[model samples]
Target: MTDQAVAAAVARRFFGRQRELKALRADIERTGLDTLTGRKAPRARVLLVAGKPGSGRSALAEELADGLTDRYPDGVFRARLTEPGGDPVPTARVAQELLAALGVAEPPGAAEDELTELVRRAFTGRRAVLILDDAVDAEQADPLIPDDPDTLVVGVSRGPLTGIPDVRPCTLGGLDAKSAIELLTAFTGSVRITVDPQAAETLVEECGGMPAAVVLAGGWLAARPKASVADLAKQLRGLTGDPLTRTFLLAHEALPATAARILRFLSLAPLGRADAHTASALAGCSVSAAATTLADFAALGLVSAADDGQYEVPGHLVPLLRAQLEERDRPAEVQLAQARMLERTVRLLQSCRAVTEPEGSAARRKLAGLPRALRFPNRAAGADWLRSRQPVLLASARLAVADGELDTLARRLIASFVRALAAHRGAEAAAPELYGLHRLVLDVAERRGLHRERAAALLNLADLDARTGRTKDALLRYRLALDAGRAANDPYAIGRAMESVGGSYQELGDWQRAGDWYGRALAQRLARDERADQARLYGRLGAVQTYAGRYGEALRNWRAAAAGYRRLDDLPGHARALSEAARVQEYAGRPEESLRTCEEAVEWARRARDTRLQAALQLRLADTLDRLGDPAAAGLHRAAAERLLESRAAACEIRSGFEKD
Candidate 1:
């Protein structure tokens, strides 16, 4: 069938989206209404049909194009941005290609705006439909959209084109059961469907209303002439027990031997917003060869254009590809190829995250063959690379874990990415990301029975929990980590875990236990000559003593902390020492010294931009003001404290001493 014919056929038969189609039609009508009302149309010229890899996005785009065809007389233009292997074609190339389709004679150049203006002019004064298929994002597709009032540009993509603000995004999801069944019946004989109606219905349900899988299942039954629909359903159940794979195998198995191997290899290929280079590497061929293979797959509806030159497996086909990959009993050659595939992606990840400062020759060897783009030309480029590849990095970690290689690689990947992310985004901002990484790291470590890594992961997780006020859970995890550290005979880890456990106890108002643990942690720090850390421990110990009304002991510890900080020459630690000592003095009714200490703390705070320290000093001044009977000044300081607390909750060193349940 011709491309346009197929696109038209796909549009006409779009099913079970009566409500959604109406909403889309209504949106389209609104655009027309604005023109008729002689008012300015919404500045948004782009119509985005956004959804995941599958969920019938192309069909929706085609339907919208078909709906607008009679109104658009200039001509309908369609461009595919992804190749079969899910690689992204560049925007410049796509824009140039799109212009060519619009009958514009123009040289592609570095000037993006000039090209955009030229493309917009081609469709001027004529109503037309422009379908931008398999777009990577708005940056890739939005440039091609016409500014003309008569043009309707529909972009199909796996995710939101967040870069565009005014584009009316019509998000598509999976097919409903009725549509899935109808899709299945289109391929399978109706006689077979009606003979065992219940089984066919069950089969459709099993496909999760994913049209591709349903059609594939029906296709498999079509090839098996004598197989009853019930029998085929059972066979499909055994095929992968997943709608995605169940259908993928039905079609993949029908391929010639070489193509099937290529398909499975493509399945294991690093899927991301990829470029032609990765797709070529996956196909074990040149870029042109991979491009041709991608075109073939697009023709078969098994792949789509993800971007200008990128091709991808249909989203729903991923699971099936994975299933097909796992089922094949391959020789060492194939296994080596797969390992190389993984290594290539690992290189990409290292370039994107740049977490591992090369530890040895082997690490360097593993990363040597990466694309130069991964090296990041500048710091801004590196930051942008990490942001651009974040999703791919996460998917790589998950793929490794799912493939039972977590013990070897996934833990390190999670830890390295987690650390990198934390460094880029300060801990307070990245708390949620850190929590997920800790969970994944711990799981991999436990699965591999690597106690040291497990303990480290547990400690990190406990810290997040404690900071979030889940001290009880934090206490339990910190103890577990401590036990693991002890089992490994690691003094540094054990000491740190002890301090974490103690901190949790302190938050729960268990001063005696907090003192004990802090003492132990301090002793370890002293033994290790970690004076900087020791000073912080002493401050924590002093705060617990003060909160328990042991003013003298608190002063002794605070003074010791002050001496330690002075020796270490840490300004922040020095400020904390002064603040704690002042609080202890105030509790002991030495307001004169307390007032002097708070003044020093405020001076240090102003230099440091330590709002928490300023808040504490303000509260302390308010307390002094109360004792001296200065009502208005005290109330103003109290209000300032409240505002600071609300604005800087995470940065503030809150004195939380909740009673244990």
Candidate 2:
């Protein structure tokens, strides 16, 4: 989607921000609208929309960005600087997300400074608008500001961005009476307001002219269409304490018994958003019933229907709901509700992954045993659900771990999340989120002193670090994993950690240390009689030896790997090992031997039905033959390689066509 379209879809309900918008526009104009006129301005103009959490700061900023899309034709980009748990998102992560939206491929594992530079470079020559939402402070907002004259940044925050230079602050308060009444009418209809105009005005006043309060009051009246504005006004007047609180209490009190119970349980929603599945799980009710209740809640404005089809408790109402929950429910009851929700979420997550498994597999069989209500229709639907619920799922994991008593459930949740995400979106695509989940697991493991779980979490996190080029960090985590594994007597973790340590050293260009660690890991695998791991370790040792310019040693290790694979009946592995041996032969100045090795590898690749591998070996043979002064054989091999490539391309085209059809 275009960035402008993304910004426009940020929020759907905007009622009274005209004065704020006008002031923001005037600030932009004062900085020079030269970018709109096809000329460079002095610098990017920043407008900070500051207000309390419930005051609609984010929505106002979104509206402003949406309106300026024409002036900033390059496009608009938006990023949330705060996480769901109200944690400040790291500057690097914010930069990475924004860079992706800007169509820039961020270098993996880049530090904040580098990513900040990339963000600046992306906006350097463009006349675009960027919306930085939920910024907590100047530190979180400063690095993201582009240095381009043609850019505009609208920052949304609960307070002014104190140290940002030249930021025009537009502080928001309650909405105006007319706009507030209009917003209320949108929910309650004009008939009730018209029937008793004075009572309607008094009701809006009781709501303190806050859009959220007005919506809740309007919703209460809407649910009871026969109720008059004066009656509702009198009810609010009778309540005590905070206006918003009183509004929430009155609205909540108006719910049916079951609906009221569900509303109280909604405080358990991760990020204040829940769907039918979770609602059913939380309340121990049927999915359809929960769905109906949620729909009713949406109609009553107790919750709003999100674009993802889940119901979201308005940000302002969340605290009130939480308060009500604490008051009406015992701690034990709350914990039970949370456990029920998480347990059900785990089952649904399992079903999500089971749909992707091959039919008749254990996973699929287990999925079949689950009630139909828990199972997704197919892989596509499951993946879509998983993608849409990503934020909530992550928040669930965070809550589970923080609870300190649901370690087992948290582990299952993380494992299912990892496998499901990998099956649907690939681990690399979801690396950032996976990284956070792993950290939570590690935190729980460390606190509980569970060595095995700690070892596993460490290894997983270390692998992610290595994939993103943080070799030193990976090395440290690998060492810790090794210690944890030893403490827990986990042979698999021990062997894997040793091998990973070697890989990290190899990445750091420490050939001797890499070889030593690989040899150690190889010994562990051999001792444990792990044939597959032993073969893999041999290949890794060969790679390290090759990097060290020890051609003979590399050849010997590769030959061992090839023999092991042959004994194991793994044709592809045998072919790959032979290919590596053949390359080393060439590197060692034995062209004839390399040619012979390549020929054998090609036959093995063909036997393995690996078209790409066979084609690659064929090309390698052609080069070796040409070096050996056999031009005719080289030409034939080149033609054979071309045919293999053509066959592979044709097969891919047919597969694509089938998928499309």
- TM-score, per-candidate, Cα-based: 0.55, 0.86
Question: Residue 369 CA error for candidate 2 (Å)?
Answer: 3.2
Candidate 1 structure quality by residue, lDDT tens digits, 1-661: 5432342244347667666667776776564545678877653367778876556788777877776757776677888787444667666556666765676655312246766678767877768888889988777777777767667777888877887755677876668767777776665547887888898888877777766766566656655668787776676677755576666766676776765666666666545334444555555666566566555555445655543455556555765566566778465645565555555555555554443344345645554555554454444565665665564566566656666643565665666677567655556765655665677777777787878988998988888777766788889999999998998888878998999888888889999999999999999998999888888888888989988889999898998898898787666677778878988898899988887887787677666677787888888878877886887988998898888878786444343323332
- Work out candidate 1's RMSD over C-alphas: 17.1
In candidate 1, position 228 carries an lDDT of 80
The TM-score leader among the candidates is 2
Against the true structure, whose lDDT is highest? Answer: 2
lDDT of 2 by residue, 1-661 (tens): 3322222232366787788889889998774455567767556788899877667787788788888878999988998887544667779878877886787866445678999999998999999998998898999888889988789999989888888867889998888888888877776667888877888889889988766678778778767778898998899999997678888899888787778888888878887789998898888789999998887777666677766779887666766777788888788878888889999988988899889999999999999999988889899999999988987898899889988888888888888888888888787887776787788889989999999999998998898889888889999999999999999999989999999999999999999999999999999999888999889989999999998999999999999999999999999999999999999999999988888898999999999999999998899899989889999999999999999999999999999999999
After superposing candidate 2, which stretches have Cα over 4 Å from the reference? Answer: 1-17, 32-43, 74-127, 571-661
Stretches > 4 Å off in candidate 1: 1-260, 269-292, 308-312, 315-338, 354-370, 373-392, 423-428, 593-661
